[model samples]
Target: MRRNIIPIGDVIAVNQMLERRGSALRVHMHDACGGQSFSLRADDGTSADEASRQAVGEFFSARGHAVEFSAGGGDFWAVRP
Candidate 1:
């Protein structure tokens, strides 16, 4: 597994834009080798930020990675468990 830190603000902004367009927000992730990609959809009635966090958590968890959040929720990083 690898550690990848994602900016919270950017994810939230993109999700908000998708919400305004009545489309589901999709978070995509690629494996460390960049050989595979996965997409997770945001759930309805949940804030984009929260949904993003959940999706990221689930993604990392499935691959035996650990997800850690930064102080004040500014960002998150996924790494080997």
Candidate 2:
């Protein structure tokens, strides 16, 4: 499995956002983004759902970067932020 890391500061920021949002952030399967299939999974063996994906995407976008994934089983890459 391939791995990617979001900086500790970004992580903390996301956590703080989640903490502030509380359970309202929980996403249902039907809310997935276009029913996209993600080959990359976290260390916990879970893949990102739509809400989390959007959050991460926004985080990187704010830094002038974009996260990309292959259509099949492949690694994740980020553009310069």
Evaluate all candidate structures by whole-model CA lDDT and list the values in order. Answer: 0.52, 0.46
Candidate 2 lDDT over 1-81, as tens digits, reads 332334546545655665575423322111133322223334455555566666656765786546665554233355444
Tens digits of per-residue lDDT for model 1 on 6-27?
A: 4455445545655675656555
Estimated TM-score per prediction? 0.37, 0.43
Point out where model 1 deviates above 4 Å.
1-48
For model 1, how many clashes? 0
* Per-candidate clashes, comma-separated: 0, 0
TM-score winner among the candidates? 2
Which 10-residue window in model 2 sums to the lowest lDDT?
23-32
Most accurate candidate by lDDT: 1
With a 3 Å backbone cut-off (N, CA, C), the pairs that clash in candidate 2 are none
Please list the Cα RMSD from the true structure of every candidate, rounded to 1 decimal place.
9.5, 10.2
For residue 21, what is the lDDT in candidate 2? 54
In terms of lDDT, model 1 sits at 0.52
| TM-score for candidate 1 | 0.37
- Specify the poorest-scoring 10-residue window by lDDT in model 1: 34-43
